[model samples]
Target chain A: MRIILVGSDKLTYFLGRRFTSKGDYLTIITPEEEAAVDLSRRLKATVIAGDGSDPTVLQEAGAYQADVLLALTDRDQDNLIACQIAQDRYGVPQTVAIVNDPDNKAIFEELGVSVAFSATEIIGSMIEQQTASEEIRNLVPVAGSGVTMTEVVLGPNSPAIGRAIKDLDLQGAVVACVVRRGRVLIAKRRSYLHEADRLLVISEDDQYGQAQKVLTGEGA
Target chain B: MVSNLIGGNSSASKYIVVIGCGRLGSLLAGRLSAEGNSVVVIDQKESAFENLSSEFSGFQIVGDASEMATLKKAKLDKADCLLVVTREDNVNLMVAQIGRIFFETPVVLARVFDPAREAIYREFDIDTISPTQLSADSFMQKLNTHQVSTSAPTEGVA
Candidate 1:
């Protein structure tokens, strides 16, 4: 796929190497000439040194042929404009941007960016999951799928400790698997939950809270 | 045309928010303030405010125009008009969009350096000024007039 990346940071280099290794055509636009030269030498991709948000620069970077555009600039405004121009003018199918300010994520989405992610929000959510409780160990969101995988450890007082997987009242979630004493077991209908068993639940993103409540008898 | 868009001649105290205290922004804010209108100028750098004259009676805000926090602090909702003249075309476009779409400000004007980006601003019904295009057109007209006068004298001699 033809990919256009805006901004030249560590993330840019990582993505450039991964995509080029996969034989995908990559074009990188950055404002720093030195960084562009370094990136061109390191990665098998075209690098152009210019303002990524400028329409002329984007045109020169072959935005028209881009299957996806990723705007990872530090400035949210520049990232937003680069994505906007790539989508609106170049007819790129998908555009993603990194919002420096978490508050601007919604605004970027409202303005028609395909995906707008904030690093701070992601890190904050990870921290929240770590400090949430002993029972809930982790929450991993499946990007673009609207699904989440939550790892819940059953404690002595867990509501599902004595019940079978089929008996648990899950709204839109299912017990995908269970780990008991380091043994991975595929969850079956008659699989009985036990204390110290780690249940990996896959559920719709919005229904995770209800799923958590059903297993722990406490709201997420 | 720009002054007319802001309702130039009328003597009413209209609250205005001017983004970017650069040359154009400072000049516009000063003129509006002198005309008895309440004006507020916002810029990312405080030093940009030094361009404003002492006679300019208006509030100054040092913050990014593209951020919603800065716009809220400037009370953009209370403004009768918004003027954006930041150096970056994208910054000017973003700020003007926030003012026009989010706050639904009645009058929004932004100066876009790149003439190619003017269409997007006009699509949203925001007034945009392209200095490069404007100056180029003005220069072309002057060159044409000079040619006409010079050719007339040559024609008379012939």
Candidate 2:
């Protein structure tokens, strides 16, 4: 996959390394020449030293051929601009932006950034998840839809442990996949769950808590 | 044109929503409110709103203008005029576009820093004032007048 990364932050470095290590064609646009030089030395990636928000910089970064454009700039403005320019001018298939302010997530979505995520919100959610009674961790979301993909770890004494996948009163929820003792399997309708089994469910925003409740019902 | 219609006395007081509480947004919100228009000013940082005059009677929302939920919370759908004056030209353009596209606001104005953003605004049929262009024009005007005045004789200007 041809990927264009903008910004020289640690997140940018991490993503660039991941993509480059996979041998996915990666082009990084960093404003600082020193950072670009440092990154290019470490990874087999093309580097464009300039503002990613600039059309010329994006053009030099092979934006037209990029499958995904990640705007990881620390500045919300730059991220917004880079994503917009990428989508508008380059027609990049996917554009993701890292927003500092959580409120800008919705705004960025309105502004047409394919995915806008905030580190603060993610951290807050992780902290909230840690404090919560159930050990339900959010997995990847189902692509463009509002439906969320979540993994629920069934505690030893949970309600649905002994039940079949179809037996759980999921209420419009579907078990996409299941992981048992690190073994992955397709969730058959009659597939049974065991204690410590992880079930990945595709559910809407409002259905998440109910799904959690059904999976992690009354017990320690 | 739309701004003029909204500002005229023939119409009822227009609902104005100003995104960003920077010097320009704060002053504009205060002035618009003082002129009997209903104004709501939004900013992510609460401290930025201290720039507004104490006499300002408009509402204030502490939130990001780019977020649709924040706009809904600010009741921006009812705005007759919207002003986006965020520090970043990109943010201002996005917010202004939201005002134009989502809310169908009668008049949407944006404060843009980069002169290149004027084309984006024009593409969206939104109005924008770029400080760079304004400054350049003002500087050129001043330069021309300065040269003319300096070259002219004291009493009999050529």
Candidate 3:
């Protein structure tokens, strides 16, 4: 696949290297002439020195044939405009942008960029999730699916302890499996819950709170 | 006329928010406020606000226009119009998109230095002014008028 990566020299170099190794055509656009020369020597990809947000620069970078355009510039506005030009003008099928300001995620998505993410936002949420509750060891929300995977450890006084798997009214959540003393146990109707057993629960995003409350006996 | 385009009733003062606070932003804000319309100018650098004239009577915000918090502080959602005149074309375009798409501000105008980027702004239904293109057109018209009047190159220069 033809790919165009704009800005963030280090990220461009790494991604360019990875994609080129997979036999994908990679083009890197940067504003620094010196960096362009250096990157061209280091990577097996075309390197162009120009403003990423400029339509002429993107045209020169072969954006028309690009299957994907990744705008990883530190400046949120530059990334946004680059992605916009790539998608609207060049007709790139997929456009990904790294939003420097987490608050701009909605703005980027609303503007029609295929994927917009913020490293700070991801890290911030991960930190919050880690410290949010003691019983929930890990929680992950599947992107665009409205499904959540939660790893909850049953406590001694938990209402779910000593109850059979089928008897636990999880409010539409399903118990995928259980982990006891690091041993994976597939959740079955006859399998009984035990204190300290880690349950991997899969549920709709909105039902996770009730599911967790049922298992851990605490409001999430 | 500006008030009418922004949907403000005739004889009523319209709220205008100008981003950048550069020469154009300051001057436009000053003129709008002088016209009895409420105006607010925003700039990343506080020193940029020094460009505003004494006749200007409006709020000044020192903040980045790309951030929603800053725009919220400027009450951009409540503004009748938004003028994005930042020196950076991408910045002007980005802020204009936010105002038009998120805040739904009426009569959003942005200054894009790169003429090639005007298409993106147009596709988003945001109005844009390209100074580079405008100046080039003006220069071309002047050159064409001179050529039509005089055939001799030396005479045209003189």
DockQ numbers for every candidate? 0.46, 0.25, 0.69
lDDT of 3 by residue, B16-115 (tens): 9999888888888888888888899999999998999998999999999899999999998898899999998888998998899789997899998887
- lDDT (Cα) of model 2: 0.84
| Interface Cα root-mean-square deviation for all models | 1.3, 2.9, 0.8
Give one digit per residue, the lDDT tens place, for model 3 in A46-149.
99999888889999999889999999989999999999899999899999999888888888999889999998999989987677547885578878998988
- Per-prediction TM-score, please? 0.76, 0.65, 0.75
Residue A49 in model 3: lDDT: 91
Candidate 2's C-alpha runs over 4 A off are: A31-34, A48-50, A60-67, A74-77, A98-110, A114-220, B1-5, B148-158
Worst 10 residues of 3 chain B by lDDT: B1-10
- Model 2, A91-158: lDDT tens per residue? 89899999887878887888789999999999999988685445687877777787898878888868
lDDT (10s digit) by residue, model 1, range A66-86: 999999989998998889888
How well is each residue in B49-119 modelled by candidate 2, as lDDT tens digits? 89999768988899866667889998878878888998878778777877887788888888888776576
lDDT, residue A9, model 2:
80
Model 1 captures what fraction of native contacts?
Answer: 0.46
Candidates 1 and 2: which is better by lDDT?
1
User: Higher lDDT: candidate 2 or 3?
Assistant: 3
Which scores higher on DockQ, 1 or 3? 3
**Fraction of the real A/B interface contacts present in each candidate?**
0.46, 0.29, 1.00
User: Which stretches in model 3 have alpha-carbon errors above 4 Å?
Assistant: A127-220, B1-10, B151-158
